[model samples]
Target: MPDPTDVEKARSQRRAWEQNELRDFLERQPESQQEYRSASGLPVQRVYTPEDIADTPFEDIGLPGQYPFLRGPYPTMYRARPWTMRQIAGFGTGPDTNGRFRYLIAQGQTGLSVDFDMPTLMGYDSDDPRSFGEVGREGVAIDTLDDMADLFDGIDLERISVSMTINPSAWILLAMYVALAKSRSLDLAKLSGTTQADILKEYIAQKEWIYPIRPSMRIVRDMIVYGAEHLPRYNPVNISGYHMSEAGATAIQELAFTIANGIAYVEQVAATGLAVDCFAPRLSFYFVAQADFFEEVAKFRAARRIWAKIMKQRFGARKPESMRLRFHCQTAAMTLTKAQPLNNIVRTAFEALSAVLGGAQSLHTNGLDEAYAIPSEMAMKVALRTQQIIAEETRITEVVDPLGGSYYVEAMTNEIEEAVNRILKEVEELGGAVAAIEAGYFQRGLADSAYTSARAQASGKRTVIGVNKYVEAPQKDAIEIHRNDPDVEARQIQRVKAVRASRDNSRVATLLDALAEQARNPSANLMPITIELVEARASMGEIVKRLREVFGSYAESPTF
Candidate 1:
């Protein structure tokens, strides 16, 4: 901590600079905008001094890996080991995605993130009528254990951390992963990965929910409990603000809403007779690194602080690990543009840097061509290289929390933390995340923020370089678009049919019946039964169909 007298002297110096030095500078050249603000509309000052953070206590911004974790979650941070570089790979058939996964791993990518097709995400099979034409269009198609096996083919699951970006059908995919590991004689305890099983975000932003809030939350709880007890290395749920942020939430809103969702899950899990420490330590988060460089960095810092307090005070968690907020970050896909596709490379680089500075445990940089479609192989390689350059070339990792004591960053961190807490309090008053979702509170806030941002971009208030400011003439041959394989859907459909034909129908039916029975039982942990169903050769669609009969489908209420 600095001397109070020195801080006071610095305050005087700041006043003098504004009065004389800044006045003369402004007279010579006027400021560009009448008001400077961040992407989330937080006011930005021209200069910051010690006076900005004079009132803050030293303990509030303690050392890295300490209480509150404002500096960072780990003490050495990237110095000990750089964040895991994960490229989200999934497109075409299972074999196609598996090939891409191998390419990325061979390129030195450290982690794996799987993207599921629209049908897979929505819990539909490739052969279902509703899934026609859309199968394997957006991502890889997985209809059964065979597809899951093909997806991971020769990869060592025990070594690589896998992140599955699916929610509605996350449980089934997780089960398939477990079954695959068991078949290979791999210990379930050693398998590492995250099931992006945050269903509240589905109702709040993505709208990919299968069951209604109550039963869906039950599934989340079951996974948390099971993961805590059995799969200690696997993160059952990645409480995500990435989708919510992409859908138009401000940084503060994203932080608040994501934590609110996390609080709900903690409560739900605790209700299952599990101690807070049992599951809290395994709870991880996923967030987006948007274009606001300082603001994004500050948001991550503040998130760690807020979460530490919540786990300790709110939930009575005693373990330090339980209080530490571990998270994975991805570059904001919404920030990418098709107008000048190559410019996205620069955008992703800066966002990736922000995530690194903010202390992400793992990160996925968006591919330059992702604005148009799934990234091409070259585009994906470039994204992976972006992270490598930051981790290796930049000596920024040499120092932990290099920006910890910066006046501007500290001020921003405090501002974000306070604002997030205020919003979280509002959520608590509205009866937690589920109640807020049902009452359209979260949805309305996200929609309004999104509309506001869209309008700002349209009106040129928020300048998106390629989309708003830069004017480029149309050229058909300038940028390459990654086209989806036309044969992908047919191949996926035939593969699923072939697997069904080969599997034992009677055994599959019996397993499905057992799963449905377990689903109906209020106290049952669904993970074990889900694993059994997958082992019995039950297809993703068949298992979801059986559970849907018990949980029923959800239809969101219109919120304007």
Candidate 2:
């Protein structure tokens, strides 16, 4: 044989090459699965040369923010602006939330994402019997306008963007927000931020809500209309795929379901006869960054390209901004392990890296102590520091879409898009996402993937550093777990009672009666009455009860 060239010589030197060569030779004996691939399942070749990416032209893979937007959103992505740091906050009372907001701001956090307790999420006042055991259990308690006002007391609404996580009661929260900003003398137009007004996902994943589906959609439509007309800077809905992923959905399930839900929202609002381009620009998303680093990054790139194509091609959107999907990301919570909490730090780091690399607009790294409970200050600091190190110490932000044209990444992007489309087609066959969700398609998918993932973990096919490998003895020192003080409940209940006692009870009754009347009509948009009722200090339970009078409560069958 002729003398091997330098390229061939180098390729032959690697141990993996010999293994691959041996496998290639054994293919003659009997081939089982010719296509071995990544979790996203892009084909893994024995080696990649220029041949693998020959068809992926430079034009198709143009610089960031180009027509395709496959690489990144902007050419000078992080060089122009770093992704916003938004730690998911809100615990105890409004004053407590205020202090935490100030604390994060003082510590160099760039944005704020608020979390709410189970009662608040389900539209229950702290005084309600339903809210008794759960007041401020998971997050902050806001029973009326006073609590909402106190929540952002000194924080300048115009200066910093905020994201509130709430569903069925999203419009009430928005109304409270508007009132708070008005009290602070902030112009409605100058206000910025979002509300997790995504009700569809609640039925799909989170399972926290008050009203029925059609009525819930109306609430969302009202907010879309309000945000477009008055608060142009505000995102009325943060349509989330993050929680779906946290609920153990696979990456493609997260992508397809989120985009499908987005499609439903756009359609729902348009049914109200609003222009597509008006509110679509401000529509945002939240996705999880999981352990599959490269796949997660490519999924984001593919998401932008897909959404841009859908809005322009399918929805006939002319606005460039309508095509762009601005989103926030949090590292995968499902990946955390109580067995080896310290390993969580490294896990969060990798997932955060994936988020930044994936071009997330905002992010939150789950604290290591999250496996046990609410994070301690030390744990939260470590989580924040993870992002700072990646942003400042490492020079990853120097260029936009740094891995834009890697052959492996490009291949992975195509694979993920294809897989997500296949799933979307399956969803459509079931008569759209809502119908599919009702039929338990999403839950089934999650269950199957979760089972597979769990099996992998049990079999040691998946390597969790401290849990399955590099094992360590349990430490004698006790790690601190943050607990919500029970006084938050008493104070919240007392505050609601005080408002009920002092407010013009007749006007409150009148507004609530009107709400109940409109709610019974089913055709009435709840926003105007919701705003009026919130202004009148009607408790969340009162508003929920009004709706519940007409549309009966649902008992969702176990999806899996």
lDDT by residue (1-560, candidate 2, tens digit) is 11236335545564565578766877677655566655544566655544345556566566677656776766678898789888888788788888888888888998887888889998888888888878887888988999988888788889899999898877889988987776677899988899989988888888886766767777788898889988989999988998888777777888989988888888888887788999898899889999988889988988887787888888888887788778889999888878668789999999999999889888999999887887776787789999999999899999788887676777677677778888877877897777877788887887787777777778887777778888788775447778768688898888889988988889988998888788667556767777788888887777777778877676687765
Q: What is the C-alpha lDDT of each candidate?
A: 0.91, 0.82
Question: TM-score of model 2 relative to the true fold?
Answer: 0.92
Each prediction's TM-score versus the true structure: 0.98, 0.92
- Deviation in angstroms for 115 in model 1? 0.5
Worst 10 residues of 2 by lDDT: 1-10
Q: Pick the candidate with the highest lDDT.
A: 1
Best by TM-score: 1
lDDT of 1: 0.91
